[model samples]
Every structure is written in C-alpha cells, then in structure tokens.
Target: MHILQPRHIRLKKEEAEELLKRLNISVSQLPKIFITDTALPEGCQKGDVVRMERKYEDKIYPYYRVVVGSLNEKKNG
Candidate 1:
C-alpha cells in the first residue's frame, strides 16, 4: 500500500493449491507471514497464501508467504 512496499495479494484456495504444486513445495515449506502484518490484505487468515509482487530492475518477481497467527495470539489463543 505504500510507495515503496511490494503489493500483497491473498490467493484463493485453488490458486494456492496450484502454486504449491508448481513449486513442488508444501505450504509449511514456504516462508511465513503473520496475519498482523500491515501489508497483508484483508480477510487473510491462518493457512492462506499471499503473493508478493516486487519490482527489481526491469522485471517483477513473485514471492510467496503462508499466513500464520500472530505469535502473541498463538500464545494466548
């Protein structure tokens, strides 16, 4: 949402599945992102996958993260 921040998009269930298959990695193997992260899109919850689009040089690269509950919440809930 910021000028310098990468765009984050929450992937649907089917898309997430396809991505995992294409990458040959499970959701747990992907990087983790907290649900409380400011850049995460609304409605994101635990087990959701987010795609981040970052521009470098003349091309854009895609990065993925699996949403997890906040540490604090994990401890309390």
Candidate 2:
C-alpha cells in the first residue's frame, strides 16, 4: 500500500484526465489515498491527491514514502 503526500489537490474531471494523458499513466499508477470519510465531500470527485501515511516493521527495514491518488468507492455499506 502507498500513501499520498501533500494530500490535497483540487481538480475537475477534465483537468485530471488531461493530466493523466499528459503523464501517460492511469490512476492505478499513483498511490491510493483518500479523505478521512469513506465518501468524498460534495462537489469533490475522484482523481484527487490525498495525504496518507504507512508504517513498516522489520529489523532491517527503512522508512518509506508514498502518494495517494484516485478515491475509491465505499466498500461496506
């Protein structure tokens, strides 16, 4: 699992699409992070950058960083 940094970016669907096209990548390529709530706020859609953190536990492991993109639909309920 990856996390998003500088987590909040506001952009419309078209803008996000254009960015993806320009970057030659899809949402899956980016990290998966989302707002605290399961559902995005009104007027806010997917393809948004969100801040997140991940923890690793191992004797020889080092800290890692991540960036989240594209909000997923609520799973339960």
Candidate 3:
C-alpha cells in the first residue's frame, strides 16, 4: 500500500445495504473496482462492496465501490 493511500475495506452485508440506502441506489448501480486492485482487502470475493477512504490535501473522502472480476464484469444477473 502507498504511504498515503487508505486501506480498502470490505463491508458486511448490513453495511453494504446501508451504503446503498444512503446513496439511494442498488449495488448494481454502484461503480466497479477491479478484483486485482492492490487496495482490496485480502479474501474479498466478487460482488462484494468495499469502502475506501481516500485522503488528499488533508481531506478525507469516502468512496464505496463494488468489487468485480474484470473490466467488463456484469453488474446484473
């Protein structure tokens, strides 16, 4: 991990649902994060949601991304 990069966190099912509720969107509508992303926490699986707290210029931004298998991974069944 980069010195300045925040850790990528996996969310529990409840937390993931809460995040989706806050955004008024379903997990399928969320952005994708490649499974190979270095920040991804170990043991994370496809279709999981990750929370990344990015820090820049002393500001911390919260970002939620859905883990996907590949660049063209499908979001819906």
Candidate 4:
C-alpha cells in the first residue's frame, strides 16, 4: 500500500450487517468499488463491503464501498 493511499479493509459478515443497520441503508446502496481495485484487500468478493479510512486535517473519515465485478463493455458494431 502506498503511503498516501487510504487504508482499505473488508468488513466481516456480522460487522457489515451492523453497519447496514446503523446507517439504515442496504449494501447495494453504498458506493461501488471494483473487485480488481488494487486498494481493495484480498479475499474480497461480490456483495462485500469495504471500509476505507481517509485522514484529513488529523481526523479520520470512514468511507464505505460495496465490491462489484468488473463491467464488460460490449461494442456494438
């Protein structure tokens, strides 16, 4: 992980559930991060939630994203 890159962690099943309840939002509602993203921790799969910790002005802010498969763009000829 690069020094400037924020820390990314995959939440456990129970933790994810609690977070959803606390936020009153479903997993699908969270922002999406591709499964191939280098910042994402290993062992992540579809429907998994990743928590990103970003620091600014000496304060840490948590960002959440749901793991999703890569999108394949089809060219219409």
Backbone clashes, candidate 2: 6
Ranking 3 against 4 by lDDT, winner: 4
What's the candidate order when arranged by decreasing lDDT? 1, 4, 3, 2
The sequence of per-residue lDDT tens digits that candidate 1 reaches over residues 1-77 is: 78789999999999999999999999999999998999999899999999999999889999999999999997998
lDDT of 2 by residue, 5-43 (tens): 223335555766776797797867755535444433334
TM-score of candidate 2 relative to the true fold: 0.41
Inter-residue clash pairs, candidate 4:
none
Per-prediction TM-score to the true structure, in the order listed: 0.93, 0.41, 0.81, 0.90
What clash pairs does model 3 have? none
- Badly placed stretches (over 4 Å) of model 4 are 73-77
What would the per-residue lDDT of candidate 3 be over residues 1-77, giving only the tens digit for each residue?
A: 88878868899999999888988999999899889787799999988999899888888888888988965555543
Q: Which regions of candidate 3 deviate over 4 angstroms? A: 71-77
Model 4 TM-score, all chains together = 0.90
* Clash pairs (backbone) in predicted model 2: 3-66, 3-67, 4-67, 4-68, 7-50, 7-51
Instruction: Report the number of the highest-TM-score candidate.
Output: 1
Each model's lDDT comes to 0.95, 0.44, 0.87, 0.90
> Candidate 1, clashing residue pairs?
none
Judge candidate 1 against the unseen true structure and give its global Cα lDDT, from 0 to 1.
0.95
Listed per model in order, the count of residue pairs whose N, CA or C atoms clash below 3 Å is 0, 6, 0, 0
Descending-TM-score candidate ranking = 1, 4, 3, 2
